[model samples]
Target: MALYKTIGAFLLFLGTVSGYANPGACSGTCVNTHDPSIIRRSDGTYFRFSTGGKIAVHTAPDITGPWTYKGAALPAGSSIDLGGNQDLWAPEVALVGNTYYLYYSVSKFGVQDSAIGVATSSSLDVGTWKDLGSTGIRSSSGKPYNAIDPNLINADGTYYITFGSFWKDIHQVAMKNPPKAVASGSSAVQVAFDPVKTDEEGAFVFKHGSYYYLFFSKGKCCGYDTSRPAAGEEYKILVCRSTSATGGYKDKSGKACTNGGGTVVLESHGNVYGPGGQGVYDDPVHGPVSIRSRKTIWLIMLIIFALQILYYHYVNTKIGFADGQKQFGWNTINFSSGWPVV
Candidate 1:
């Protein structure tokens, strides 16, 4: 899941973006998004929390959508008793101040008996979320990190949370109580690792200009109905960079994402197969400004925060997830070679 924060007038507009052209191919309900997490409420709507029925909820005034099915942000699921708990995994929404939390991810797929929960909302609608189960951020089985793919970020003013998967992959912590669990006596700091296939997980971090990019997801995500991991080796999308949002990440040859480096920003091209669950933000605009219409590139998502999008999830070897569906993609970044490509 990917939460976002970096808006002080967009921090010099998230530094750089140019020639945008394609964040296209989006339509109603945006197709079965898993691990998705989007936010945009101050009255323009746009919700969209993802990963299965318990945390589903979708809405959209524009982000290039017609998205409307707003239903479960825990409609009676996840009291945190664990074991699938009505199916939830990676939601991660954020709006810290007028309250909107929504963290999520209990666990059941390779079993670490994980945790990581939270739910709140002042008005995201869909019955106004409020689960509040656990945010202790747990994991088992020799835990080195495997709570699940969460990703909250605020940096400079603190608030971090970069979860994990695949044991010993990505970790980070420093969100206390009202900030939402895992802080008292802190202990999570890995930040990004692969050490030759510890097989990363969806980790997103973004501060833009002074660095802190990070963006994970690597190797075998999902079963593909039994076997399928060796043509670019399943899931893709990788990145690294850091000036210290908790660790010293690196890439672009400086190499040090915990010694496994990282660089490919989206992989398995052509009809987009296995393209990681990435993220980035900057979509604000409150009034008048237009983009000259290709039917209004959906008004560049509201046209202001640069809409530097990086949304992800792919697989369409003719409708993949082994035909169970897992789509919902995007791209509008171009950070001018300082990294981010799409």
Candidate 2:
């Protein structure tokens, strides 16, 4: 009982420092998402698509989910010729007209040999997809910009996509009507680049009131097993905003996003590590929602719970331990400051 009290106190301290008790979003199977892009059905069900195994799909009845794995959005892999890995990375889902378009990335680890492909589905279910082929976007050996992590946006009906990494960070291109393809002869523009860190990608844009917010991830991701990661290497979510969707994004400190300016939205805290690869969805109930991936604290709790079970059985045990009750609750984080409290 004393050990449990200490653990609870430590968690409370961490939450006080981080300005959040727990993320008010969904958990359980709903929490295991990476580069997540979420969309809502007509029946109020939320479908979440993410990076992995040809684009994994999860669905839930509410935004706060008891998410269940459905299947891959793209089962056969990408039609793009530059593929070295069939496992898609960073899926962005958008509803255009009556159809849903899924944009995914194909790359060879850290190399610039990458392409963004699209697949269309009339319904968000398994085996209902048709690959729309590549968006004619690619990053070659000598190109300054990467052509992965595609995010489609509509600026007053004109479609555009923002994508890139490493070499020149984030770039935007004018997209054609259906948005599965780039506009003919439309030049890609350099939007957001980090001159200092040079480690920005997973760009997602959301328009709220008077500004278009550009959210990107910086530093290394997917290195969870490392003994102790450095501050700069751990994945964290950052944001900048622009009046126009095209350019001139700045952080809260009035620094240019091109010159390595970004305000941290979410970062590693306690057992929740490497939070990045985010997407924004406008919820009918919760208003605006941000989704991402992080190794959560509950895994650590489970391990501790198992150890407690062993301690109670074989070691010094608590009296009437079986009579102890556990309760779980939720507390929503306020995002009026343009970021989740953390």
Candidate 3:
């Protein structure tokens, strides 16, 4: 109980540091989530789609959510004829027209025979999801990229799905309309790569101003329990930007992202370790207000919850994800110096 309280206090401190207009913070009992993607409905309801429990669907009245699990989007698992369809991973949601499409990953750990699946919903409620099978994105042992961590981004007017894993880091491909699958005759383009075994993955592209910010997770991700991955080798969030969403992204040092260059957006700090599995969203009342689509006002709020498991600060020190299994966290993101500081 004391550990939980300490976690709460850190969350509050994070919000205070971010400098929100209201300085609202969140910290409570949170279930674990992997590769989470959150989006707000027209009614201001927030839906969080994540891995496990057949793409777990949790809804909340607010961003600092007392989130309530509604039901699995694919209760019986994906309709795709993949071997690990039952154990789907990396769910990314996109609202295209009146339909909400939820893209998921189908694979096991360390296996290259993987595919990205999709399902559609009109209301994002139980019994509303219709499986759409594969998005024609898959990877094999000989492939350079893995087909997990499906992140859909609407770059300018074109749609693209950026995904990959440890195999070759992150890759992007042009996506056609409706976003049920990749664009015809489109080939996967390498966007970001690390020469050192390429431990980066979980890529999310957010369009802020004239630049499209690409956020991704780097270093070892799972199976944490002391003396693992060293200290700096643990998972952390990194970012790069490109004028064109397809390629040519660079870090703050102006280093090309494809050549193992990335700027650290979020990393181990105090009690939060391996802080990754990130996505940026616009909240109507949190960070920076902007106009998205209609006349609705929105702010920037990022979801960076993928740590193995972190507890409270003990004796002025907090442990890393090597302590426990896994859990989740979210915080408001404020911009500074033309960078969306996560």
Per TM-score, the best of the predicted structures is 3
Provide the lowest-lDDT 10-residue window in model 1: 1-10
Q: Rate the local accuracy (lDDT) of all candidates.
A: 0.75, 0.70, 0.74
Q: List, residue by residue over 1-342, the lDDT tens digit for candidate 1.
A: 011233322332543243223336678877778667777787787777888888888888866688888689788888988788788877888888778788888898888888888888888788878787877888888878888778888886778788898777899888874677777888888977877679888898987778889888889877776788778888888888988888998988998988789988777766667877767766543222456632554354334324367777676666656524877777666454567765
lDDT of 3 by residue, 152-234 (tens): 98876789999999888899988888788889999999999999668989898887668888888898777665446788888
Model 3 misplacement above 4 A: 1-24, 27-29, 289-325
lDDT tens per residue, model 2, 1-342: 687556645544554576534345554464335677778899898787876768888888875677788888888888777665477888888889999888888997788988888988898787998988789888898988888889998999999999998898999999889887889999889888877778898898877667898888888765344343576576677889989999999999999998889987666544445556776655544542222322466434323322110000000012111111100112333333444333
Span of 10 residues, lowest total lDDT, candidate 2: 307-316
RMSD to truth, every model: 19.5, 12.1, 8.6
Descending-TM-score candidate ranking: 3, 2, 1
* Per-structure clash totals for the candidates: 0, 0, 2
